[model samples]
Target: MKILTLHGINLNMFGKRDPKQYGTATLAQIDDQLRALGQELGAEVECFQTNFEGEMAERIHRAHTDGTDAVIINAGAWTHYSYGLRDALAILKCPIIEVHMSNIHAREAFRHVSVIAEIARGQIAGFGVDSYLLGLRAAVSAVQQG
Candidate 1:
């Protein structure tokens, strides 16, 4: 199966941005781990990282035409407010699993709400980078079950 992985906003600065909250792994390192996990599961993983909201939306739009079977996205701050991202996700026929590195609910009040969760197949958060792997696994399982 083909899975598209998207990293949004400040996530590109993962390791360097906040070592306490986001851990010490760079975005590239996280992608490497996810890619390894995907290979182990016999799935092809294509990843994209963008700080721009419109670019992320464009990637989501492209996923539909790229034969993507599922999508795993960590929309950073966009999780709380980007209706455009939610709308892009809504348009996809495939399953989408929203992921967060930190537990948003435990953070600032503003981080507690996720606009994208309303339209996602499921959400995985608060497990650090494991959230991405877990989301991917869940997405793969959902695709297989369907």
Candidate 2:
């Protein structure tokens, strides 16, 4: 299976930003772990990160035609208010799992809502980098079941 992992906004600042909320793992470290885990699950994983919403949307468009089997996304702050990204993801027929390193619900009021949740197959959050891993596993499992 082929899976695409999308990391948006300030995610590249993972290890440097708020260690109390996000773990010390750098973005590259997180991606490497996801890729390694993907291999263990017999899936091909491709990861993309960007601070630009438009670029992220364009990447999602490319995935639509790129034969991507599923998607695991941790759209950072975009999760709270990026309809463009949500609509871009809506175009995909494959399953999508929205993930969050920190638990949005337990954070400030502004972080509690997600623009992508309604379109996603499901969501995983609050488990640090493990949330991404679980999202990948869920997406792959969903794809296999279908």
lDDT of 1 by residue, 1-146 (tens): 99899999989899998787899999999999989999998889888999889989999999989899999999999999999999999999999999999999899999999999988999998999899999989989988987
Stretches of candidate 1 off by over 4 Å are none
| Whole-model lDDT, model 2 | 0.96
Highest lDDT scorer: 2
**Cα lDDT of model 2 by residue, 18-86, tens digit:** 999998999999999999999999999999999999999999999999999999999999999999999
Global lDDT scores for all candidate models = 0.92, 0.96
Q: How many clashes (backbone atoms < 3 Å, residues ≥3 apart in a chain or on different chains) does model 1 have? A: 0
Per-model TM against the reference: 0.98, 0.99
Query: Model 2: residues >4 Å from true position, as ranges?
Result: none
Query: Model 1: how large is the Cα RMSD against the reference?
Result: 0.7
Candidate 1 residue pairs that clash: none
TM-score of predicted structure 1? 0.98
Clashing pairs in 2: none
